[model samples]
Target: MTDTLLPESDAGNTSDAVHEDRLWCDNGWTARVIKNEDDDGWAVEMIKDGEAEPALVGPWTMGRDKKNPKPLDIGAFNTLVKTASEVLRRHEQQLHAQLHKRLTVESGDGSVEVTLDIVPDEDDPYALLTAFDALGEQLAQVKVAPNFKLSRAGAASWVENGFRRPG
Candidate 1:
């Protein structure tokens, strides 16, 4: 078979997709068709480059012979890439929401923004509780447990207590 060349932008993208019968790679994603472990069918796995786990995996259609898996083509590969990219995006948004939180509360002086940023360290997981005034000037910051809950009542209490460490 003739060797296919990628565009200039994708030429620099190493480990890219190559169109094949059961495998396709491009757009920073790889799609591989394999036998479904749970049944006598085929499955497609889409994995983003540099990621250890596949972003998406689902059943694949059978070929005309009705025994073998369908071949990977440009249209199918593009669709797989789009679906996998969406999965990664949603995952990142979820992780960010889990690791960071913010709340604004009214204090004696004015409104204060309280934020909790969690650091998921393997050995020493922790979170930082920070207070900022209306002018965006930092009022106080302290290390707290990663599970620190940032709520309106909690933030108001912290600001009222002179930004002391939450108990």
Candidate 2:
């Protein structure tokens, strides 16, 4: 019932050989086992290529003698890569949500949609607020503070005041 994604030669090496605690460039990812600072257990970090930081870090299974970390194999490496990829994807989605927000307001003629997009730059952080009519026509666009809050009341006020920057 065991399934393996790597070639037979690679799989054989992982199972038969006694590998070191760290591996680099194995199956498009790298894994490192480090002593956990918070506890007596060991931790494993999985880092993908071209990434500055490890995408996933978690507890490592102990060896049969219960001292060193269990030798990493193709199965474990594949699983770690899958988990780390998911973590990075979720982090990106969360970051995107934090940078963009939208609100709809009822106007005299129709509904107006307001979108706030934050540009996070270490040197100069700023945001852009844009308004679109019901037909998706751009009504107004202005630069605002990065921490600017958008709401139905704010959108309505902006439209009522001739699309001028809200004070």
Candidate 3:
């Protein structure tokens, strides 16, 4: 049954819902409604793309109106799916980005190359840029502060000017 939008509670009991429809997400995860066969409960299984098993499994319930959930509607279901997907996506993305990440930049003279390895620091969640030569010798290393952002040219200039740290 997919005619209604499951309330936050029902969304929690994804295993009991009958005829569960799967919600596709842009963040490389798939959410599916499944009857919790063991307990006859409603539940949702969120699985990562290309993975055989679900990354998360939770229960889903019907909306407060107690509408029969069947024949999932594309519009309403999409919105719910999108919201949930985004949260998972953000979490996965942040986790990955927190791991050892590198940003490389080539020097104007081609004599040096800069590799930025971003590490998460509670006090300063930024990266450290290690400038190295083609010969694989470290040249310069600087800590990119938490307030640092390279997306904005003004921010970059600020870092270059000593007003901020390059991130």
Candidate 4:
């Protein structure tokens, strides 16, 4: 894509500075101009690399600096896009790690399967634990606290209770 250059003002350096001709930086995010197929003015889109999609999108005002905005440009838009993408990538990774966890332990009777499922919450992390029979039948399910470490004694006890304990 062709990059548009913004006219320099009293803002700062032009080399590393993000050109405000087309976009601006707010809170370390890059905002750009996109067609607002629905309305007038323009639709501002916040892009963060690695994120599934844009972090934010809304109507934006132009030349609103001091009195109004100047314009949008390439350098400024690129910077904001990179920052927003990083933020999104981190959030996505965190969710993935919390939602899926699997562990397997061998026992005297058979094998104990331990899985930790992270439930998203605004308060604290929550998880679920399930015990399965050797045949993969669901035996029991319990609500487990976040970061709960599986204990060997518990697995051993479950096996002992189900079958003969080794002497």
- If scored against the real structure, what TM-score would every candidate get? 0.90, 0.82, 0.36, 0.41
lDDT score for candidate 2 against the true structure: 0.81
Candidate number achieving the greatest TM-score relative to the actual structure: 1
Q: For residues 1-167, write the lDDT of model 4, one tens digit per residue.
A: 23444435523534444435455543345566766668645667885434456786766555554333435555546555666567778988988876766555677657767566767677986777666667887666667666665556654564556633222
Q: lDDT of each prediction vs. the true structure?
A: 0.87, 0.81, 0.54, 0.59
Model 1, 19-126: lDDT tens per residue? 788887777788999999999999999998898999999999999999999887767777888888898899999999999999899987988999999999999999
Position 59, candidate 1: lDDT:
99
Once superposed on the true structure, which residue ranges of model 4 sit more than 4 Å away at CA? Answer: 1-83, 120-126, 132-137, 151-167
State the TM-score for model 3.
0.36
lDDT of 1: 0.87
Better of 1 and 3 by lDDT: 1
How many angstroms is residue 7 displaced in model 3 relative to the true structure, after the best TM-score fit?
Answer: 23
Best by lDDT: 1
**lDDT tens readout by residue for model 3, 1-167:** 44455456547645544433444333344567677666655666666668786666666665455543233344534455666667678878988775544443444434444444667667757776555567877756777764444443433343345433442
Worst 10 residues of 2 by lDDT: 12-21
Off by over 4 Å in 3: 1-31, 37-40, 62-71, 101-167
Q: By TM-score, how accurate is candidate 2? A: 0.82
Off by over 4 Å in 1: 1-17
Stronger candidate by TM-score (1 vs 3): 1
